[model samples]
Target: MTDSTAERRHELSSFLRARRERTSPSDVGLPGTPRRRTPGLRREELANLAGISTTWYTFLEQGRDVRPSLQVLTAIADALRLGEPERAHLIMIAADETHPGEDSEYLAPEVADVPKMVNPNPAYVTGSSYDLLAWNDAAVELFPGAIDAAKPNLARWIFTNPAARDALPDWPVVAQGLLARLRTNAGKHPGSPRFQRLERELRTSSPEAEAWWPRYDIATSQAGAKRVRSRSGQEQLMTYASFHVSDQPEQILTIYRPA
Candidate 1:
């Protein structure tokens, strides 16, 4: 299989495994068994609940060449109790191929300009893989040298940039959150070259990042607060909100405001 196909298969398998692991036997109305080695429902249990053969489900989880029908996917999703985003992502990965047309990764000029419009709020736009597509003056002022990296990769900056660690007082918390968000981005767009490149770079360059990657912590874009240290060495809390760009669904507009 090609790299894209292989990536899709890997993502599908990983997604299934993650979701399955998160769902417990009790959550699915099954009795907890002491013999269970895993935390969640076993493959056989999930297969039985989904009305499919254990062998087939196991094959799917193993990233084997198996195409599950829509009905089968829906059944498995229900059995795993996937949320709407998770369910949509599941369907997307299970598909043979994504829609072919324009490049979904491309951020339009208007979309890129969105951050500028949000001025003074420290707004920036990130692509699906968390690449810094665009940012306003406030973002540059707040993030400092970190965002001006050669690649301007958010994940890279979080783990590798000394300035980022200094600027964000809660470095460990921010780094962990960034890693979790990166994992989510990777899962959502497994075939994205940008994500793949960043992943490889991080794995090789940042030991801290490599160690945290396997946790498979998934994070969604949401409003939150961040504690940051200013250039003057004064610390302050900042509240941030994430907005999905309607024109470019893959791009997110994040604005950080003073708390």
Candidate 2:
């Protein structure tokens, strides 16, 4: 098997095990017993819940060369009581599905102009890995030094930059959300060099990233409100939404307006 395939299998195995251990029997409507030694539902219990053989499920958890159909995976997801994001992440890794716009990195001039068009609002365009591809004056004012960096990545800035804590009033919560989104993206693009490098940098530089990486959290980016401190140290509530570039799906245009 290729290195990427092996790495993906390992990730799949680890993610499954983590989710399984966190899911309690009571959570799945199974009677809980004090006699249970395992942290959560037993392997056989999960297998039965999913209508699969215990041995097969065990092999899958062990990262054996077992190919599970989509239907089976769905059944297992239901048994595990995984959320939508978690279910999508599981399917992406287990089935080794290729993400859309995995190789394309070309950003059209028109697409790059989107942020500037959204004048007064803090707007920026990011690549699939959250790299700051383009930003407007408002965005620069909102995020000082970030847009000026040689390789400005949102995730990297959130985790490694000390200024991020001051800029974001709720830094921990925001960081976790960003990390979860990154995790979901990582699942979609397994063995991506850019992602690998970013993960390594985060884990090495930030204690929170190191501790949270193994949790295997997954999240889809969504419209939300955030409290940001401007360069004047004035706190402001902003509503943010992201739009996918029609032609280049990997390029995301995010705009923040006063809430």
Candidate 3:
């Protein structure tokens, strides 16, 4: 007997979540009830809209024993009002496909254009995984050796680079959070060239990093206070707000404000 495996079921689950939360009943043509217990559409409602059975929708959301056809996936995508990037992400996740080559060149200029003039507060843009791709003068000045686009990557610097150790005062606390995020990304993109490159780079560069890498077990980063030591001897603790750039699939906008 052969064991059937689930593929892209996680992606389908993710797509379902992102879809339902994005639309309220009023946003679509569905009736809104103040007494409704669920925050978003019920499984029955989603099935009704997608022209499928509630049991089938439950299986899809449960990520159980399902290999949805492209036509069916397209129907779900359309029903969810998914934009191009969101649609593509749903498709890729469902297929369990990897796009490392496309993923590598993140932080396109259009996604987060550098200001003609630098601001007082330090800021930068990275990929979805917080891989620092670009920063302005203020960001560069704030962390003397922080943004080196040529070999700049947040994960590598956080785990391997010593200069980064100095720039970020609370390394011990932040490293755990950062590595957990990398762990999740790695699972999604196993054997990817860039991911492998970063993994190897960290392993070779820091044995401490290698020891801790395998134990990481989380996907998202928490909005915690980040502190950095300034050259003048005081610490610059700040609030970091992370935003996803809608048009560019892999870009993020991060702004730092003084604490």
Provide the TM-score for each candidate, comma-separated: 0.85, 0.93, 0.59
Error of 3 at 199 (Å): 0.5
- The candidate scoring highest on TM-score is 2
| Candidate 1 segments exceeding 4 Å error | 99-105
Residues 1-259, candidate 2, lDDT per residue (tens digit)?
Answer: 7667766787788888888888998899998887877788888999999999999999999988898999999999999999887888898899764433343367889988988898999999888788888899999888776777887888899999888998999999999998988887776676787788888999999999999988888877779999999878999999999888898675788999999
Clashing pairs in 3: none
For model 3, give the 10-residue run with minimal summed lDDT: 1-10
Each candidate's number of clashing pairs is 0, 0, 0
User: What tens-digit string does per-residue lDDT give for candidate 3 at 126-223?
Assistant: 66455777677777766666566576777777776677778778887777777756755654554455666777888788877777665433445335
RMSD of each: 2.9, 2.1, 9.6
State which candidate has the highest lDDT.
Answer: 2
Cα deviation at 222, candidate 1, in Å, is 2.5
For residue 174, give model 2's deviation from the true position in Å: 0.5
Cα shift from native, residue 20, model 2 (Å): 1.1
| C-alpha lDDT values of all predictions | 0.82, 0.86, 0.66
Please provide, for model 1 over 202-253, each residue's C-alpha lDDT reduced to its tens digit, 9 standing for 90 to 100: 8888888888776566667889999988888889899999999887666788
Task: Tell me the RMSD of model 1 versus the true structure.
Answer: 2.9
